[model samples]
Target: MPYPLNHWLATVGFGLAFCILASGNRLRAEEVDFVRDIRPLLAQKCFTCHGPDEGTRESGLRLDLADGLFGELESGAQGIVPSDPQQSELYQRLVADEDLRMPPLDSGQRLTSDQIGLIRRWIEQGASYRSHWSFEPLDPTPPAEVEAEDWVENQVDRFVLAKLAREGIAVSPAAPPQTLVRRLYFDLIGLPPTAEQVDAFVADRDPNAYEQWVDRLLASPAFGEHWARRWLDLARYADSDGDLGDKLRPNAFGYRDWVIQAINADMPFDQFTIEQIAGDLLPQATLAQKTATGFHRNGLKNTEAGSDQELDRVVRTVDRISTVGSVWLGLTVGCAECHSHKFDPLSHRQFFQMYAFFDNVEDVDLKTGHGKVTVATIAETKQRRETFVHLRGDFRQPGEKVRPAAPEFLHAFEPRSGKPDRLDFAYWLVDGDNPLTARTTVNRYWMHLFGRGLVDTVDNLGVSGEAPTHPRLLDWLAQELMRQGWSRKRLIKLIVMSATYRQSSQPRADLVDRDPQNRLLARQARFRLDAEGVRDVALRTSGLLDHRIGGPSVRPALSADITAYSRNRDWVVSEGGDRYRRGMYILYRRATPYPMLQIFDAPDTTASCARRDRSNSPLQALTLLNDPVFVECAQHAACYSDWQTDVDWIPQAFRRFLSRDPSAAELARLRVFYDHQRQTLAEFTEAQVRALCGESFAVASADQHDLREQAARYLIYRCLLNLDETITRE
Candidate 1:
């Protein structure tokens, strides 16, 4: 049976202690930690009606605050009296009669008997509250020592091993050289390795060969193209306006190209953040910086006649605020627009204060001729407009006026010279004293590399978010990111070089039962490639990639049925090498994305998507088997000439596509498949062979016998492309 949600969350939140408890082991009196044990339980069960939002709080009481819970309540009783569980109303209400129980039956939440016992014991010991983990300042101490001295490759490994030691689990050994090299190639560049490159690294005996290979891949131009796709998800980038018309925007490619160039140059992340947010407001800003301001212009715009212009503009403003909150601080600040935040300590007034910063941006629609595109950009006027709270998120009814400011719950933003604006907002985010920005950014990078973040909810680090399994390690990484001058490349290099990153993705038989999610870092994780990475691997392995840097987005051929789904579609397929560019450069229409990417779970570009879901389904399998792109890739892969005999091709094909030679069993299985296909092709008549090879084959060759040979080889290529290992990043 599957574990309960609270039980699983407790296991993730408390690390080893919860593991022991869930295994039915007895817990000592000294092991109960209020922050780790009691806080999450209250936040999940009791906080919704009794916590941060003042409008919904019950009985003039708040359980989330220390003073409110421990002090006297309006009912002439204390909710939580230190060292006295019998007198504490908090404990009494939990074990009360069904009708008077906390989290009343209608609320669809109930505390288990064990949970009640835990609370009673916690209050009996003394109810001590610690600050929420993410809100505390980052810890700057070194990692704790571990028992496995020789296993220590860096500070990252020390922290990971120390946790495993506490759980009585051992770390998995390093993966073989073939698996290591393949993992490095996909992780760093988002492409598969060439057979020759794979062989060279496998044969190299030097101890530093792996590090040298990492440096080489990081410096490659493809590295920028690969990483840029990740940032575009947060930017909400699309080639067309989303609603009714879905009209195209031609100049959005400028922002896309800017991201690639910035990452390739190893731009300091602080400067990168500043440029994207306030580049247009800077005095004498460069053309590239102005283009960077296009980040805000990427939101959806309604161009249809008779639309509500004022309401549309207000929605755009909310999108910017919500995106910034999620992308920078990992908070769902948007939840406060209608009322005070129900979970985090953000009031409705603070939401409008941040909205004031974006209200002055001059972005109005321009009329253009049919099929022509116009650039959407940021331009500010001399006078800034005042911002107000929309009563219950209604644009028609406005409440109290507000000036520009950051959220009050975080570090205070004190201006040094002039009135605070968006530029000031950007600087305040990256300031060392503020806690969330660096930690959030490093967590995102960790997710990209390790298949999961320390805090699994990458977009929210608020009260509603999951607690980090290793809180100290997350703080250390955040401090290290700031100490390195906010250099993204430097931080990435350190993570990839760590011993924790080098562990085998294969699970240990002993630990899988205890920690299936691998939150304790007992082993590496294996996951399917992202949508872009999946397509790019097939293109590179088949030698069909263009390798050209960014220019304009490409329109590859799509099925007629997919094109007809859109009402105002005008997709003209790009000619020549443009059709073969990397998947990131494919034109993305918000209403109707390319079918292959949509099937593979690419973001819809409607909001800020910090992470994309990896789904496995029959449609994905069918697309790889029948899509024109994959079929063309297969044909191209079959045309290469390297093997001497018909059977000699199988192992070489495996090495080229999978980065390793096939085993004896796999080779024997594939040889039978190859022979069956060749015999089927030979039996076909001349006219049947011509029909099987499309019109493109007619132009290339008229010989029926040769076409039969190539078609048989194409069958093998198609099968290789469909293997699970080919698309996974293990």
Candidate 2:
């Protein structure tokens, strides 16, 4: 049973983790010496046939729980005389069991001789049970400590340096200026620096050059475009509803833009979270804030004809709730949906409890009168979720009635408010006691800036998560997050300015051997550029990029064949068309994604994704070399080369793409291409040249599309623009 959707979020936050009987043993079985160890060993071997389950519980005993192990058994004799191996009844039963063997059955799965020896060894060391290390929190002070006069920055470094120092290792000094600049640029803005930007920092002699760079990057509008994208990916951003009928939601660009705006404004992280979760309910929410409500709406939807939309909607809510828990809390609360969490502290009841919080908020139809909108809703009918236990995860047979509540692990969170007041729910998440919310948020920031979180699993910081490399640093960052009134920008600036973040990705042989993974932040991790960055970089370098800010999304030109293959669509490219050049103008369709993005790890947006997987694949190679978009952008670059003017167009072209003058070698190659193209182009008459240039040329000896010289230049220019390094952030 679940609580009503119409209620508030407070219900689930309070008492979510119910105290259920813990299912697993609190300890592992102790070992025994051969005969003495043999007693228990025999029991394990014998227990399966006589184990704790139904058709068994054999030998008038069970082997499952501790209570059963000690209880009276058919063999009796108190199972074994305590501490007397020779007198143990179970031991005698096992070795003598060939005829009356206690195991009762033996096959290929029987224990080996070494196991019997280990059991004998176990008996020597008295058997004792202890829980897994993770269930409990660490002591106030870890046994280890790293104290460095200058290498350390925060407690995180202290912990890491302490460990390394204890082992006689040392962290490298600050990286050089070029490495630092590139690190900060990519970390905060998700783009590489222009050569000029890099040169400025390296050339600067100021001690505070790095700090100034940090401030500049965070303040730039590009910061939001980069970081909001990280958030959006986590929020499961998609342009269209998912599934067969996943039509593009053109207006979704508003939500994307809003996120960018929020980051640029340095909105308090808590408020940012609140706005995303329940911005619709915010008392003073502007249209942008309301637009943030689209976070929940960002998950998948099924709009196919005859699809059971209701089921899909509910699944999405569950996914949203699960995404929120995982993304913010680092708990796999979703695991408790059918049974108690097999490993963590969450229980099945808690899953529904949280599920109930989102039950009432509706994914309502936005259109009036039939067919007034762009896309239809997935579920044809809207029905309230009735509270019921989904028996064994099967909704058809509900077993228990439940109200919204929290999971058992954190055990004592009290929600001061109630249901669809999701705002209260959002507020509770931001509350101080909610350790998960802050830790997860900061860890995500760490992951974004450094390419990996101190706790590697950014989404799972709970017991199952890796112990924090710098627990103190993580805590300090979280505390700072709260102290600074949850300002994301301040946190980002702080990290970018840190010496740890500015290290070069270049490796030191010794450090490489000791810390090849670089999780310790000896240096910044080098990463290839993402899909959007690749496209954006091309356009920006080509001087063809339109920097005009927000408006309706621009529909980019696609190959006629590619467009024809999907939805029988078409896109015409024009030299000066309204949306021909901006990278952002490209449509992010749902069902039929553009090949360039699809191959570059773009999320399907059908689910809330906390991370967009970065994959290295061969297809990505083909897309860059052969994709129509790259081809067109390349052609656009070549358009700048005016051979008729007799100017050195290659150097000019290099400036547009590389942001610097070309090398003499590069200039030589372009000159050669130019000379060859012009000589070959002589065959074409002036009219044909004009025809090729998309203009009328007065010519005698020319092909139909006369402007062969210009066309050849554009084609060659396109090739240079599509090179790997040209698009990659590194």
Candidate 3:
């Protein structure tokens, strides 16, 4: 190669020109943290072509790095001629004729007016480049202290309370004890405490009682069910697909139950993620491990007519990438599918590299293994689903091919195996240095306990994410999670055992005026029972709950119209079948989700739902007051006591349903109601009263069920079903 004197002269001139400028204004221009500023912009706008793909280039332009942008291309054109915006090819492409948009066809979301201004100013101001913030090695010590020393509950509280102080907000007061119990119970076990359970805890003289409860709940089998459901939703648990109505994955629940068992077992979170992603790949993967792989296979399928089986399966696999990222990484990597991420530190090419990890495996029906093949944990029977850059997220239009690689922004740590695949994919995700996996898992666990994540959005924690209310708190939890060997149960117990977790929900009048949302947690967040918790309580109190454990999903009795699911749907609410007797698992059969559940807020099975919104609606009232399940449970509940024998029926009923001793006032009102209802029913035959409770005459109970004796019991059932205590953590 000839060293040209002219080239050397030009390079020296360029270096001198930059030095002259630096001499005039030596203070470095606003420190450009790539992860904080530039990486997000580059990642969002230019990573697809000018990025990691060594395979292809369009029009000889690549904006991936400063050298790539400033150096000459094969065509002798440069992306940018620094300090010459008019001469720069890069600027021209950005503000190009719509027909030649730099992002290319159909990748809309061109740079914002402000964004364009930033690029123009930076380029004109001598465009220096830097590393992404996340890629920089971590600081072992916490950053300088923030605010009020007294306000800081822990080092975590110090960070968060400081942020609040800066915003002129104050942390909320401790929540009331009732609300605290409800919150803790649901947080730990996905269920609520009985009224009696609440009272006992409130009366306990022992300070250790709450701590013991948290421990026991974590150990309980029900704890697995509660935590398992969260993981499953992320896993996309579903049992059927294809034209033959719903093709049942008869044993799909096995995976669901497996997750429950794992959580209850307090398996380390690192091992937990490894098992699901590469469980079947383990040298000694047990039957349980193989079933855990079902988590990957749990996503829903579109089995309708004319569907492209292979293509659909591929889309599902890609979606799996998005799900895995959001659920585990707390990042929105999905945005990079077509071009680049517009607001985060991930390039489109890096996305494809990650995509390559899951590219090779195929999806086939577990049932037929015929017809339209589907891709999934197919990585199991063979290899994990393979990755490929789906052009603009479309299957048929092939673009440049890519092999698996981690996002470029994560330069600090790379996957262990030189080759990228699902197992390597699994490894990179939970690697100790990886920032997101530990953070995401801990955030979810926190959200479950506190009713809000320290990072409230829970799923999105990228450039677009909300600044964490308690950055130190979240980091502390993450450190503790890993410190405990990634044991989820240990992390959960630690959070619950914290002084913040046990604080009362009742707001101090002065504090209430000070803090509104209670981001500071002057006390715990008061929580309303979720649909599952609410339904479970009603059944539990009324003596109607079917406690049989794990199998398939449940399908509570529904009116024929709801069951028929069509224009002329019949309204047939059945009571005689096992559907009413099986546990929550056996209640399956998609056409009709138990009506009670639907009204209370169960998400549609058609998609994934991480949070169920708590809403108080008129429909909730109607369902409780009139539903056959409620009526039946109330009847049975009344019968369980000494309605006509040893004790007063109404008071006994009150004790069983409300778990309260019952006031004289409540008993008197029930006595009046019983006399009137019995008189009205007495006029009718025995069949008439029997039919009223949604039961057959003489088919179940032979007595009038002691209406006088049971009236208080029915009242209690109705009251408990609607109690603020029954549905509330407080």
Q: Which candidate is the best by lDDT?
A: 1
TM-score against truth, every candidate:
0.92, 0.73, 0.74
Candidate 2 Cα errors over 4 Å, as ranges: 1-160, 167-176, 284-286, 364-385, 417-421, 462-465, 566-585, 641-720
Rank order (by TM-score, best first): 1, 3, 2
lDDT of 1: 0.81
Ranking by lDDT: 1, 3, 2
lDDT at 240 for candidate 2? Answer: 74
Q: Give the clash total for candidate 3.
A: 47
Model 1: what TM-score?
0.92
Off by over 4 Å in 1: 1-37, 75-77, 96-112, 364-375, 566-569, 640-646, 698-703
User: Over the stretch 1-730, how does candidate 3's per-residue lDDT look in tens digits?
Assistant: 1111222123321111111111121112264433345555765676555564443445545555557777876656667776677777777777889886667757664788788777777677666665433233333346348656654444555555555556565555555565566677667776656767878877887867877877878888888877776676566566554223555555567677778778877888878888777776778866666666666576656676787888766766677777777778777778878766655657666777776655665543343243442223454335444345666767676666677777645534455566655777777777777777777778888877778887767777776565455655676677777878998888877776655666666655654444555666666666566666666666677656665556555445666656667521433333443354423453333444456666767655554555666666657656666666666666666656343654366665555544455578656655555555556656666555545544521232444545433544444455445544455665
Residue 76 in model 2: shift from native, Å? 15
Q: Which pairs clash inside model 1?
A: none
Estimate every model's Cα lDDT from 0 to 1.
0.81, 0.60, 0.61
Give the least accurate 10-residue stretch of model 3, judged by summed lDDT. 13-22
